[model samples]
Target: MPTAQATTTTNITSTAIDQKTVPTTKDGLPTILNHWDCRSSQHPTPVIMIHGTFSRQLSQIDVTQMLHDRGYCVFGIDAGHNDNLYTLIKPEYYGTAHVDETTDQVNAFIEKVKRKTGAKKVDLIGHSQGGLIIRNRITRYGGKDVRIAMMLAGTHQGTTLMGASKIVEEAMPHLFPIIAAPL
Candidate 1:
């Protein structure tokens, strides 16, 4: 049986599995059956990796390689190469918020991955704010249809710096140049 390990942050609890005695998969990939079910015989489902602010898809290549070796497909999405949260949220002119745009991009990526792999669901892994986007999709947008979600160093709740910046942005729209410069 897989033991459960839970981590709590910002009033939300997420789980991990610890299965010390189980045999690994035929490919020797560690099995956490409680966390994810193997569909190795099925055509591989693409894994999506989301990177943090100013980071690129290339940053996740090593991780993608590992997943590929384990019999999974991998892909990454770039979040417009913005330096800070403020700029990403308020682009030159925007119809969607930063998070909304990023999530839309992810949703589109999922469709593309599904079409390419001929799989029903894709796994999602996100780093930093990328993880927040994953959570938003899962919890708010009903993305439980996704196979699995892994978040590394994600900021699920609004950060202190974000709160401060929102206040400043509301108070001084004219200083957006200065406020957004170092963001």
Candidate 2:
């Protein structure tokens, strides 16, 4: 014989935990490099990271963790999202937006990060397109809050695509600008 009893379940919400958010992209998706609450007291200066074209902030997790391990506060933003529906499928490719829009997003993210950590200035590290955006922000938009900026293999001369682009350039000189310029 089994006895059945009606039981009531109550849902309780706790306010003890604090919730915080940092903008990582135009779509506001959560990224692997955003650590709003992990601001290090020992390392007062905060470091911000931006990924290269056709990449996401998550690709910079290694850098973020390295900085964090060294007691530095690190945050990141994945700007420049393609307006096409493909973004919905592969959101990781977030650096396809127009240059103006991309730079604007980076500037806004930098301002937001400065406000969050209460840091007047921040160190910026960018790769490829990210670096271009940083340069544009600093030179064109007056990077008033940038303490230092570093660009990794982001030369305007163009990327070799790990040597593949060089091959393409030699094979088809006419298609160099057509195929490589976009990258």
Candidate 3:
């Protein structure tokens, strides 16, 4: 004689009570890495950490941990396909992907984070090429989801290295094509 309405009410109450028992770390933070409790009163906006070219999320553990300690929900993305060559080259030159490609990746990452966390906006922290990626996302792409952006050693304008890249491009136009080829 139990009605469908009675069954649905029981399911909803059980689910809500189960969520309250979810375990957290010693600091009362969620044990899941790169996850934030969007329902938290203190931190509504999550932080999206973008690694510069040729780097992966693993390289940003130190900074991530620091932010977590300060009670910020932190997330990161390994933009582009540079994981294979990460160990071989210098970190600076490691992220050699075209800006446009990285920007696209950043845009997707921001959207994904926003969806997952149920957050309206996110703060950005970019390092080196990571910085440019976020900038392109915000300016070129429709990145209204971003709340604040901070870049470390980020290049707003193209790097000159005292015009080294320019000189090389001029001297051997064909070489530029070969060097710029996708890995």
Candidate 4:
């Protein structure tokens, strides 16, 4: 079982995990777990890890654990399709969620982390589609709470699917136009 520490910030009490015992990589870094916390940490700012397309917070466990071991409070969330049914049945579709919706969720999570840690700003790390979500939140959704944003393998320009869709658009002319419009 994971070890947890209870912290009282304002009127709220949250359990943060003591990940010292969690498994680590060959380089000696803890593996991040969902909702794991280290609130007693002295670090002023927290770190948020966002998973890529079709993935949940667990996807970036290694990175999160690394940050925690480095003395930063880390958090993660399952944005877009967070429902259990959808996550279990068809996780890939989770990436299909609109950027606006995911960005809103990211913004909210950032606020919550800041309130809990009493930090002025938080750092963000995103992977794949998760990177795009962070970008949208910071650039479009007024996410001034973030101090630094790092993206890994993100779809910043667009997805490669767009190129394939263009080919189909030319081949089918009318049929593919409507089908590939979104891509």
Please report the candidate that would top TM-score against the real structure: 2
Clashing pairs in 3: 52-130, 53-95, 54-95
Clashes of each: 0, 0, 3, 1
Model 3 Cα RMSD, 1 decimal: 15.9
Ordered from best to worst TM-score, the candidate numbers read 2, 4, 3, 1
The sequence of per-residue lDDT tens digits that candidate 3 reaches over residues 84-168 is: 3433455432455678887887788788888888888989999877888888888886667778989999978767555766887
lDDT to native, each model: 0.61, 0.73, 0.68, 0.70
Writing each residue's lDDT as its tens digit, candidate 2 over 148-172 gives: 8998867455456568888998999
lDDT of 4 by residue, 1-183 (tens): 999999866543434544455575443333453233456447656788887766666556656755666677777777776544445677544555667888888788888887766777888899998889888987876667778899998898777564776687678988985675443
lDDT, candidate 1, residue 46? Answer: 58
Residue 50 deviation, candidate 1, in Å?
A: 1.3
For candidate 4, report its TM-score.
0.64
Q: After superposition, how far is residue 183 of candidate 4 from its true place, in Å?
A: 9.7
Q: What is the lDDT of residue 55 in candidate 2?
A: 82
lDDT of 1 at 171: 89
TM-score, structure 2 vs. true: 0.67
lDDT (Cα, 0-100) at 26 in candidate 2: 51
TM-score per candidate, chains pooled: 0.57, 0.67, 0.63, 0.64
Which lDDT tens digits does candidate 1 get at residues 1-183? Answer: 999999865542433333334354543233321123334665355577777654544445556545655676556555543445545664431112367777777777777666765677778888777788788777656875698899998877755454777788788989966876656
